[model samples]
Target: MADRVLVTGGTGKTGRLVADGLVWRGIDARSATRRPFSADQVRFDWADDTTHDAALDGVSSVYLVAPTDRIDHLAAMRPFLERAVARVPGRLVLLSASSLDRNGPMMGEVHGWLDAHTSRWTVLRPSWFMQNLTTQHLPSILEDGCIYSATADGRVPFIDAADIAAVAVAALCDLVPPSGDHVLTGPEAMSYDEVASAITEVIGRPVRHCRLTTRELAARYTAFGLPEDYATTLALMDETIATGAEDRTTGEVERMTGRPATTLASFLTGQRAVLGSAGF
Candidate 1:
């Protein structure tokens, strides 16, 4: 029998792409989700302990993706991770963020724990996801014809999630696991204004980037009914951007995938509809 790899956030952006890539390469991939599906999926919920065993059963590799929306994610993952490493002797490729090392607080906590606990591990510290322009917050831009944010004169090397997934798949499948962390990024770093301009060019529409104060941005999110903590977290992330943390790119993607990472313009052109759709 072929070795099975368990994808924790199988339905997520990077997870879905990684799972599909594995399947395309003829690997027997298993998807773990809260709800069951027709595909080779296991009913797994991060909040539920009972679902852990079945998800880890016969799995040689696991893609650890944390649910970013939850603040208690580290606490929730600790026990589950303890169970996994104890039961399965395999690679644990954790999907983390760039610059969020063991010293960066929340994400850093998870990064630190996994670094110490798992014998065979790979940390994917990717820059800002390009999908944020299409799947998540792009609609607000398209709907209002403006991208609103708290990032002030901050340039981020926005990376493609697909590129991150590709690197992850390589790490997950290699016979000899690569030691240490891989900082992934796109071809170049670009600012929000530049990114917005590129999207406007591709979609042939006028989309503007609106800069807001952190407090004002948090207030806007709060008005949208997001919890105070989440709103504050969003505000903090935007503030972090202003510090030039995401202003660098790395050669890790090209090294792992045997190809250079996609540029924001290329990503935007391919996802023109998503970037231009108000209902997306």
Candidate 2:
């Protein structure tokens, strides 16, 4: 039998793409979700231990996507991970962020643990995703014709989720996947203004970037139903970007996937229809 890889958060943006890519490559891909959307998806919840064993069964490789329901996600996911390490062979690949260091919060702690325990593991630290503009930030963009942020003139090498998934599939399927941390980003760094201009060009609309204070941004997130602490932390990330923390690019994506990272213009072009229908 082919190696069966378990993908947590299978219904999510990146996880769904990863599962599809693995299946396309003729691998036995299993999606783990609390509510299985398809027959291929097994019931699994990071906060529930009862689902862990069945999800891990016959799974030689695992894709770990942390839960988003809580700010203290590491605590919620630790038990499942402990069980994974104890029960399964450790060919684990974790989805982390480029801004988060190994010792940082949430997945950062998991990165540290993966490095120390897993014999075969890869940590992907991708920068802000281009998909965020289409998904998470879409509602605001549609309603106000603007993209809101606190990063003043700071640039991010926004990567396409497809590119990230490509790299992830490579990692999960490779006989000897690259170990250690890999920082993934697009070919170039772009500011929010540039991002808005790109969207406007592709969609032929007047979408713009609306700059806000960190406090204002935090308030917006809170109004959107995030906890006060989480909202503040997210706003603080924008402040970090304003300090030029995320103003860089890397060739790791190209190196790993043997292709250059997807550009913002290209991504915008492909997503133009969706943006238009969403009130852009």
After superposition, the stretches of candidate 1 with alpha carbons farther than 4 Å from their true spots are: 175-177, 278-280
- Which regions in candidate 2 have their CA more than 4 angstroms from the true location? 175-178, 278-280
lDDT, candidate 1, 1-280, per-residue tens: 2278899899898999989888877887899889977669999887899999988989988888987667656887887789878876778888888867764556677777877776677888998899988766766776777778788878888899999989888888873255578888888888788877887788888887899999999998889888888888778888888888788878989888888998888888789777766543
Clash pairs, candidate 2, are none
Superposition error at 169 for model 2 (Å):
0.7
RMSD of each: 2.0, 1.6
Q: Across residues 1-280, which tens digit of lDDT does each residue of candidate 2 receive?
A: 2388899989888999999999999988999998887779999988778899899998988999998866676788888888888876647889999988996887888888877776777889999999999898888778888999999899999999999899889888873354678899999999999999988888888889999999999999999999898899889999999999999999989899888999998898898898887644
Please list the C-alpha lDDT of all candidates, in the order they appear: 0.82, 0.87
- Cα displacement (angstroms), candidate 2, residue 116, comes to 2.2
Residue 246 displacement in candidate 1 (angstroms) = 1.2
Q: After superposition, how far is residue 166 of candidate 1 from its true place, in Å?
A: 0.3
